[model samples]
Target: MLAVIRERYRAHGFDEIETPVMEEYSRLHAGIGGDNEKLAYNVLKRGLDADAIRGAAGDPAALTDLGLRYDLTVPLARFYATNRGQLPSVFRSIQIAPVWRAERPQKGRYRQFVQCDIDIIGDASARAEAELAVATLDTLDALGLEGGSIRINDRRVLDWMLDSFGFTSDERPGVLITIDKLDKLGPDGIVAELRERGATAGAVDAFAAFLRRPTTLEYNPYGERQIRKALPDGAPDDIVAHLVGIGAAVAASRGSATELEGDIPLVFDPFLVRGMGYYTGTIFELAHPSVDYSLGGGGRYDGMIGRFLGQDVPAVGFSIGFERIVDLVSERTDAAAPAVVLVHDRDVPEGELLALKAALVREGSRVRLEQRTKNLKALLERAASDGYTAFATVAQGTTPASLEVKPLA
Candidate 1:
């Protein structure tokens, strides 16, 4: 599955890159990862005595200088800053690696897992967002999955909506966090929670009224009309236009056609607030009808690189939840080499058996040597379960041409 994703990414002109799993403690805590920061695993500083550890005023920096990365984007930002001179002006990179989070494990969630990410840096246009959306959809198709769609919303629009509702900048973050729980909390619960959070009463009332307003959220292909319908009158014109441009581009570039409006999977989600704080513009999540959660997601973080270089560089990335999608894949598109087992007798010389195996390998076969056992049926069943397609008996001086291979039942 990882190979499939890697090949798909490379086919899209993204160059593979690697970064260290560990990063400086400061960079990881740079206030961008949202709740993931709280979940980060901080390493204790080495050579600290029990008293020294207790004496550090409970500051994490006092205890640790480095920690494992919680996501790939932060490391990528640092990588671009450090290697900007050598990379292309418009760089496309592939990062397939494991990231660690110190959160409690849950079903379909792990403390350490692999993420398959493709990022485009140095392109600020809607084309950057479009390319990311199209490429991710293509990769999902390559994995033999179906009914994948991208739900997109811009940070600008969210901020605009909040401000229009009279939310102060200070209240915006907390409001967005509660808004993110709309699916679980519902409208009334959101208003109640906001009031409990001591949000300005008028702002809460305004927000509640907007939520209660009549809006048709029916199945419509995400376009200008659906986008307008989802938001109040007088939403930012530039953000709306930018989203429309991305939809049109994705529709044109997509590999498959559908009956959905515009025949594109792009949909405008007015309430889709991705938790990553660094996302400065166009945020998106990949959804498949098969499951309730997103298979992958990403967005533009045009300001992140600037933090390291003292100048902003536009960047957007999409990461497939590799662990979530692997089990959901029912079929594989890439064919594996034929696997063959050498069921050999004890009397056979180890060197001769190895020679036979090597000969088969040179001919493009995956060969495994197994000693002949009395329970031949059980051995063959185990081999079949392990994905060996065929087996052959080997004896003294048996050559590749002389061995007759039989297919496993």
Candidate 2:
């Protein structure tokens, strides 16, 4: 599974890099507030008892602790800082590894799940943002997602709307958080939550209306195809406009068919609050009807690296939820791991077995050889019953020079 995802990123010109799973507490906190920050699993060294560490701080507020990385992006930024000289001017990297979060496990969400992240750093161009979206789309496309669309929004656009409404700093956070729940709770639910949270009725109504309407292509060709046949062509373009515009910019820059004009669908959505403070520019989420969970999502954070580097460096990325993708792909396709059959013939001496195994391995084949008292015919039958793709004989007519290989199917 890791290899499949790694190949996808590598084909897109992303360098595969390894970063430590354990990170400093400060580096791990990317200001993605609310339950996100609390979800990180903190680490304490062995021999340092939890009670002692808690007591060492004296005051509850001043403990500098370490934590297992909550996500790959934060540690990737740290990696860039540490290896500034060795890395390329424009760093495009991919990491596939386990990330720990303390969130409640439910449905497809887990405390220990693999997050496949692809990021581009040091370039603030809209091209970076578009490329990130395209890469994410391509990854899903490879996984056989035929009916989903990539919904995108810009944090700048969201902030613009909030500031335009004259929301107070204290009020904006709650409002944005509630507005983020537009999908689950619906417009009416958001209005109620906002009203309870002290937002003016007018503000809540306007916010709900804004979310319901989004920008898009001039003709409702795609919208009609998606929502219904009776919807008007001039339906609000709020979300569609933003996504199509970014996608256009990306297409104009890269000249790739996967851009705005490409067949890969792009949907605009104002209510896509990605639940991260680090996102500064374009944001996106991938959704498909086959699965309820997001395949994975990410966006551009222009000055995110500057928060650590002192000088601003633009960055954009998207993470592919390996488990979600695997789940979706499994449902739609018959792709499964290849099986290897162990071929052991008692006629072959044990001394020459190692050479035969090595030769098969050198040919890029998966081989399994274990001692078995059963005859070759029974072994082959068992291999077939077990769904092995190919079978190999340990010894061929008492000559140990080569393996007897044949396709099981």
In TM-score terms, which candidate is top?
Answer: 1
Q: What clash pairs does model 1 have?
A: none
Q: What TM-score do all the candidates reach, one by one?
A: 0.95, 0.80
Q: How many clashing pairs per prediction, in order?
A: 0, 14
RMSD of each: 2.1, 5.3
Candidate 2 TM-score over all chains jointly:
0.80
Worst 10 contiguous positions by lDDT, candidate 2: 221-230
What lDDT tens digits, residue by residue, belong to model 2 across residues 95-204?
A: 88999888788978899999899999877665676677766666676766757667776776677677655566668878888878877898778878888998866766
lDDT of 1 by residue, 158-237 (tens): 99999999999998999999999998999999999999999999999999999999866576677888888889889989
